[model samples]
Target: MAKFPIDFLWGGATSASQYEGGHNEGGRGLSHMDFIRRIEKSDKDKVFPINVTKKMFDDHKTHENEYNFPFRRGSDFYHRYKEDIALLAEMGFKTFRLSISWSRLFPTGLEKTPCEEGVQFYHNVFQECRKYDIEPLVTMIHYDIPVYLTESMNGWEDPKMIELFVHYTKFLIDEYKDEVKYWITFNEINMIMNSSYLGGGMFVECSDKPAETCIHQALHHQLIASALTVKYFHENSKDGLVGNMIARLQNYPYTCSSKDVLATQQQNQFNYFPTDIQVKGYYPASILNYYRKNNIDIDWYPNYEEILKEGTVDFASISYYHTAVISSEPDKQEPIGAFIRNLENPYNEITSWGWGIDPTGLRITLNDMTDRYGVPIFIVENGLAAHDQITKDLKIHDEYRIEYIKAHLRAIKEAIGDGCDVMGYTSWGCIDLVSCGDAQMTKRYGYVYVDADDKGNGTYKRYPKDSFYWYRNVIKDNGADI
Candidate 1:
């Protein structure tokens, strides 16, 4: 029988921008995600640009019907937290990972005081989680940065944004210190390299700046902000544990060719650079050399090094969806997200969204992370996205999701048996919500199905799929049933 720790945190994860729909209520200001529009004919199978420009924003505001802004009303969790938390409690969840929207608290990024309603909203949510004894693992910042910061100050491109972010973090620390014990500094901090607007809130088109320079500069500031937040949590919170979250893409060589192998190694290094800085408290030499060679100038503060060293995270958290294979061949499948280019792997099955399904990759990632950092690793995000059909009887038999999660859980069991110190596993999108990649609700990834459509039409009701029951048993048995 497979055995997990007695205190293993088995639960689901969600982001405020993607799951909470009350964008305008509770005195919440606009977020960068609020300005992004869903482009026509955009699908996960094709590479699309997520960058936003002034023209696109203006067009979206005037021509609302022309674009679909699904996040503006994401699953309506802002209004339905009671129902959702009850459903999660029913699933026997020991924890629930969610993000606190920055705009909700500060309204604008430069606000001197946090909105009272916003502060109370989260207090109420945390209290509800406490009612069922579900630990709230809160992410301090997700992809949604305040739109004011991006538009007025060009986001993290300005060093001043760091102080503003720290102020916001302190507010959270003071307000929710007793309620939340587990804190994640940033969500997928490395994603700034790929989607500047979503990740760092920097408007790329309006300014005459090199994309790489802008991204790297913003990355440096975010790293510092994260470190400072970690230090603050440690100093103030009763017994808070802060973590650094990154999107972990395990890359493999397409073939035995030397060139392909070298490419794969380089890709891994690129991906690990951010984590290295966060964990080791300094920039990697290879990344520094790459920046110099590429002529990417980043303005670093004199005290930045000291801040990073003093504020290392307590743990490392990661979001692992699929593994990609890299090849030296010129004509290959285009890269999906930021950083790594990829060629399809022949050994793995493909999901509807074109991600390679490799359960063993999870095991490899766990072992690799623990070996490299010697830190407790948390599988913060892992799940499959698929299309679900509801019958007239209002039931969803999603056996495929069950199989996918089961295989991945077994992989985690193997990694633990191999002596990896894993903290917990929180599957991504515990409930169906808007997809971040293309803003589609049809590409659902949840044990509980949300009754909503891509065009924002449905009763907004929640229904549990077959996998929900399967997961309940898994959690109840502490993963032994899997």
Candidate 2:
């Protein structure tokens, strides 16, 4: 018997800034993503691709063609939505996770109304998804903030962003209330703890206060925005559901020692900080104590708790990629994720890019999250990034991807049998697109291959990999054979 429920969504995930081109069309304004240049392959290790500042963006505007902005020329989804949706339909997708570009609609973060052309684009896209019974799982904002917000107010640092973000959320809910039933408020909302720019749209160099201070304050405002998003989404859409997204950095203790275990426990709490606020409708005391001891004061609204309590989310979505080990010994720490510096898992084989290849981590994560939150858990982003090669017949024989996904799916099945409420799964980068880390298209995590290079140069044709047929069968049988 299949472990997955009949309504379980089997699909692929994508973000607008990572794949949707035509950033300048349909009255779309420049986003913060539009300003960042692609990192050269040789510079990927030394230079941070997203640690951007106001000065960097300003420089890019002045010297336009001197740099390569690969994201500006994405997989051309903006023009090929119909064709892409058809391919997904052919793969037997039940849901399609995608994001809307904020700047594409509002132009600037200050806009009271949206651009009609931009609104129409989504209408057609969502309608197409429905054409094949593919439910559109929409993310309202996925790392794409209008540059005007950062230029004027340093993005999320200012409390005024709450109002602006809430305004945008209302427009999306009111406009696509019927079209998009599943909405995610933000992508990886907790990443702000480390990456002030990508997570919070905060240019640290331009901030009036220290970066840490700005981040804590900005986090408060974003939490409020999410709560308000849930509030508005519930009131507006009778059947629509809202969710909170987190980048789940599942960490393990390096040793069985008490000190290592305690450190790992503390690290897990910090990793789950944002999810607790959104799901439990309140902050835990440990966080409060940390704030007090660190003197990280936030300007909380008078009715903040009330809003959080009332607007708790319907489900929790997370992006779980790899497992990083945490040790009490500081000297043993290395780079884990973009934001976290920690020890790597010694037991797991690692990817070429250093991500630990532990399919078992998914099972552990689902069980932990379910035990903690008692909410429906959606694996919104999960995939293996591999160097896929094309054979002589122009076929991509990605057996490694198949093996990776099969192991992960088995883990999901085990978690479900263990009584974890696993709602759905959407593998990340289903169609080859630019990697968020270095803007490289070569680091593929897709079942469908794109004939594009790192610099966005190619015919832009899409072909199904071997894993595509494998996934199609998995979805067809609802993982009965996994």
For candidate 2, write residues 216-286 as lDDT tens digits.
88888899999988988888789977899998878888999898888878878888888999999998887
* Candidate 1: RMSD to truth: 1.7
Candidate 1 lDDT, 143-184, residue by residue in tens: 888988887888888889889999999999998999998989
Q: Provide the TM-score for each candidate, comma-separated.
A: 0.96, 0.97
lDDT of 2 at 227: 95
Which has the greatest lDDT?
A: 1
Stretches of candidate 1 off by over 4 Å are: 42-44, 64-66, 332-342
Clashing pairs in 2: none
Question: Stretches of candidate 2 above 4 Å error?
Answer: 42-49, 333-342
The global Cα lDDT (0 to 1) of model 1 is 0.87
Determine which window of 10 residues in candidate 2 has minimal summed lDDT.
334-343
